[model samples]
Target: MLIDSHTNLHGETYAEDLDAVIERAREANVSGMIAICCRLSDFEEVSAIAERYDNIWCTIGAHPHHAKDRPDITPDELVEIARHPKVIGIGETGLDFHYGYSPREEQFRSLRAHVEAARRIDLPLILHTRDADDEMADFLESEMEQGAFRALLHCYTGGSALAKRAAKLGAYFAASGIITFKKAEDVRQVFRNDIPEDRIIIETDCPYLAPVPHRGRRNEPSYLPDVLTGVCETLGWTPDEGEAKTTEAFFRLFSKAERPS
Candidate 1:
């Protein structure tokens, strides 16, 4: 069994045949998935999908890209909404300096707020970081000093320095379809050497980075095997071994997610 730890299944990209897409995922051996909601407005739709599918779960929080839009969202507000049974994680949140979609200050504020909420609720934080490696590492370090909280650096393609720092801080690193890119050997190396096997997970971040063989095409939960294959190769593990390790890692981090029977 496989679990896609991060995805945006509520996006219009999957509107035409969301049911079919989900069925394909099951057929491909993807046992479960966490549908991420990057905007507060979309949480309803994202949660609805999670409620409709026994194998699906969802998260509540803002992406750093939309940080400026909801600069006033409080940690208390996040904690309140996250009380829902289906809400298993605190964010798809963190800094994304590459796009500069939101001011660095706003992004930092939002990230901290999400971190605080995760700590308060004892749920894992799903972090998204980009070109702001140094800042991100510092922020996480400072936050850890305040109080420990579980977090995953989703789709990590950052520098080794950041990876080292995050690992030291007890953060998990989730590999994405990016690992399967022909030019991603450096990323593969980081996962193989730097990240601990027990602290690693896999994702699709679909409607986005699709692995090779399916590169340039729309990604979905069904394509997770390709990413898993890449991760298994990087870690020198067989498919079954990789699945067991990652599945254990997933349940460990997102403890709120009920294991599929």
Candidate 2:
């Protein structure tokens, strides 16, 4: 079965007919999804969606944009939210210099909180690193010196140095629809050989990075095969083999997600 490891199914874009969207994904062969929480207010909505769909799981933590608002958002609070049976991971958190919606210092503080929470609870972290890869790598290296944590750089768009650094830290890398774009050949080449096969992940980052065939349209979990198609092409493998291998890689990272009964 195929898994869309990252998505924001609770966002307003799906407000009118989330069921239809999910049903479409199922018909497209997507067996599961991890609905992500982007803010304090999104936790309940994310959790509710996870509860409603047996195949969908959820993650807890604030995004970089909301970091300043959640300064008081403690590791204890994150761990508490993660105690929910359906909550399988600890973030969508990390540095985002592109928008700087929250101050950089606060973003660092927030990222540390997520790392601490993941370490404390023995859960995986979902990272979101953008233009601040150098800063992120520096912080992550320092943090790794103190202690280790399980984490994945979700929708990774970082340069080779950052990717190599994360791999050295025993962290996983999640690729999104950007890898399928014409100009992202550089990104594809950077990650193709550097990352270990088992630590690589594929995500739609949906409602956002829709892969080719539907490149300009709104994205959804159903389009994962499109991203996988690109990955297979780059890696010189068949789509079925790539799906099986990446799905295997996904499970290895999120071992907390037992196959649904």
Candidate 3:
């Protein structure tokens, strides 16, 4: 079985036929998925989807882009929300200085808030970082000095230094459809030899980063095989071996998820 580690299955893109989409994912051998929450409004919706789908899980927290709006959010509040049995991770949150949608300072604050919440609740932090590797790495280093927290670099597209730093910090690395792109061969090679299969995960990051052959279209969990295929091709492994390896790795990292409980 395969797992799409980070997906936005509750978004409007699936509003028309979410059931069919999930069914398609199952048909494609996707055993489980994590419906990520990018905004506070999405927490309930993401949790609802996980509850409805037997193999689905959810995470609760804000994205960096929405950090300014959730300025008053507290780590305790996030822990309270994550007490839900279906919630397994603390965030899809971190710095996104590439867009500057929210000021850099607010992004850092939001990142630390989510990190603190994860430490408080004992769940992994699913990070979304883009074009802020230097600062993100710095913050991660400083935060580690205070205390350690479980985390995964979701849809990782950063430079070698950031990837190596994350690995050194014991954080998992989730590769998305971006790894399959022709332009991302360099990115693929950077992680190909360095990242252990046990510390790697495959994600579609649905409604974004659709793999080749469907690159320009809206992505979904059902198309995760393309991402898996890229991972296998780059690593010189068979699809079945890749599936088993990644599925094992995924369940290990997101151990909070059980058989529909």
TM-score of each: 0.98, 0.97, 0.97
Global lDDT of each candidate: 0.92, 0.88, 0.87
The TM-score that candidate 3 achieves is 0.97
Candidate 3 stretches with Cα past 4 Å from truth are 259-261
The candidate that wins on TM-score is 1
Tens digit per residue, CA lDDT, model 1, 1-261: 899999989967999999999999999999999999899888999999999999799999999999999999999999999998899998889999898999999998999899999999999998998899899999999899999999899999987899999999999999999998889989988897788889999999998999888998999999999999999888899999999999999999888787888
> Number of clashes in model 1?
0
Q: Candidates sorted by TM-score, descending order?
A: 1, 2, 3
As for TM-score, the candidate ahead, 2 or 3, is: 2
lDDT of 3 by residue, 81-187 (tens): 99999899999899997788999888888888899999988899999888888888888888988999988989888888887887888889888898889989877
Candidate 1 lDDT for residue 157: 93
* Number of residue pairs clashing in candidate 2, backbone atoms closer than 3 angstroms, sequence gap of 3 or more or interchain: 0
Query: Across residues 1-261, which tens digit of lDDT does each residue of candidate 2 receive?
Result: 778999988877999988889999999889988999989778999999999998799999899999988798889999998999998999889899998899998998998999999999988989898799899889889998888898799987788899888889999988889888999988788668777777777899889989988988989998998888888887887878888888888888787888755
Clashes (N, CA, C under 3 Å) per candidate:
0, 0, 0
